[model samples]
Target: MAAWQAALKWAGEHWSPAPHLHFVPAQQEDLPMVEALAREIWPQVYRELISADQIQYMLGLMYNVPHLEEEVRTRGVRYQLIREEDGSMVGFLGWELEAGSGANHSTALLHKLYVKPNQHSRGVGASALAHVIAEATIAGASTLQLRVNRQNRKAIRAYLRAGFEFEEDRCTDIGGGFVMDDHVMVKRL
Candidate 1:
């Protein structure tokens, strides 16, 4: 079978019908819902890795409706919703293609992947990642890159299982006296 066919089959098996998971691009109208989910999920997910104050700060910086809308409309980052067959949103992903770096394939940044804490370990993350891979591949990106907090072992393990390798360590000053200390992970498409 062709590579694309194999990918399609894999996605179908893991996400279509049986698993009842679907990835859909977010629209402007979906901003409020996405913001609500992010607010619900981020605190629990980041609690162990960051302080409460930082969590609130980051949430405001990233998940506010205005910021999300700007990201979707102006920044060209794609926001995808993870939904169940029953039409419930469980998670979301963000990515954007980086073009013209003179590489063999374009690089896409996998900005965010958040699954509701209660829904972890149910293959939700893996399926969501696979969907992103297929989407990035279709968009002509040869690599997908993301950063995880250095102390986020669970997420690191997930990325490893999803075929990503640690690329480097990074520290970014995101203003407000906070810094994101992270390990950059990359998956080659």
Candidate 2:
């Protein structure tokens, strides 16, 4: 199979989080919080590696209100929010299941998944991941896939801990003069 084809196939596996994280589907009313998350995670996560232009474009394409609304409406974009015991939105995971022709493949793409910087290493990210994967598994999805910047070791470690194996053959490059250099990862149920 070609590299891209191989990647898609790898993306079609089941994944589950370790434990303790909750997954709640996001609603239109959650748009504000979602937008806020993009804003928050951006400076903390992307500002260092990506240029301002890249940041603007990525955030515009991924987290803008209209984009999220569309994801909620037509796209199978499921938003799973993570919170603290006190009820603050600590992190979130956005994904699309069975997005294309391979319905049985039950593929999912994780568009947004992040935990607050200060909250790192505290299991917030892991819990959110588990919540998202559990939801996908419950929906009968065969695979769960996401693109993590090759340079992001922390996020990559979390995915690996959740049982996702690096899909080196299926990296996707979404052009705009900005390269994702993404590593496709998958886990089987």
Candidate 3:
């Protein structure tokens, strides 16, 4: 591994083992693990912010194995599994390049970023975001964007602390009597 990667690995190993971020490439075989994480984390994160029915609907729409497979294989979404030194998965992120582009600034969408509830307030999300920023920069994307529920103050603050600015409000109907009311946030890399 490169020096930085080695250092990152060492940090994950020697620091608080459960919270430091070490990103492992998620493969098709890891789909079930990701689904399991969604099951565990989503309710904790969104329970008060959204209805239970909406939570279940969104989870099924997003984290099912076949959909995840299609995203990784055909839609070019990159899934990075967050792992501890002990090889336990703790979190995951998914991202993909957005459609529009310009010579000066390309955009990438941060489709998802979820850390275990117990792991919050640690540097896991920040570390994963730093890694994503570097990857986006390398891929020629100068801006990274994501959508968060408007009422999810914790997450909005986290994104703000990471230098993401509020871009706009977005409301999208996801069907099944659910609508996502969100704030679009963007960080210019």
Most TM-score-accurate candidate: 1
RMSD of each: 5.7, 6.2, 7.6
State the RMSD for candidate 2: 6.2
Q: Model 1 over residues 73-107: C-alpha lDDT tens digits?
A: 77688998899989999999999987454456689
Estimate the TM-score of every prediction.
Answer: 0.88, 0.81, 0.87
> What is candidate 3's CA lDDT for residue 77?
89
Better of 2 and 3 by TM-score: 3
- Which residue pairs collide, candidate 1? none
lDDT of 2 at 99: 55
Return the top candidate by lDDT.
1
Error of 1 at 73 (Å): 2.3
Each model's C-alpha lDDT?
A: 0.85, 0.73, 0.85
Residue-level lDDT tens digits of model 3 in 43-117: 999999999999999999989999999998876889989998778788999999876678688899999999998
Candidate 1: worst-modelled 10 consecutive residues by lDDT? 9-18
What lDDT score is found at residue 69 in candidate 1? Answer: 85
TM-score of 2: 0.81
Ranking by TM-score: 1, 3, 2
Residue ranges of candidate 1 with Cα displaced over 4 Å: 1-18, 99-103
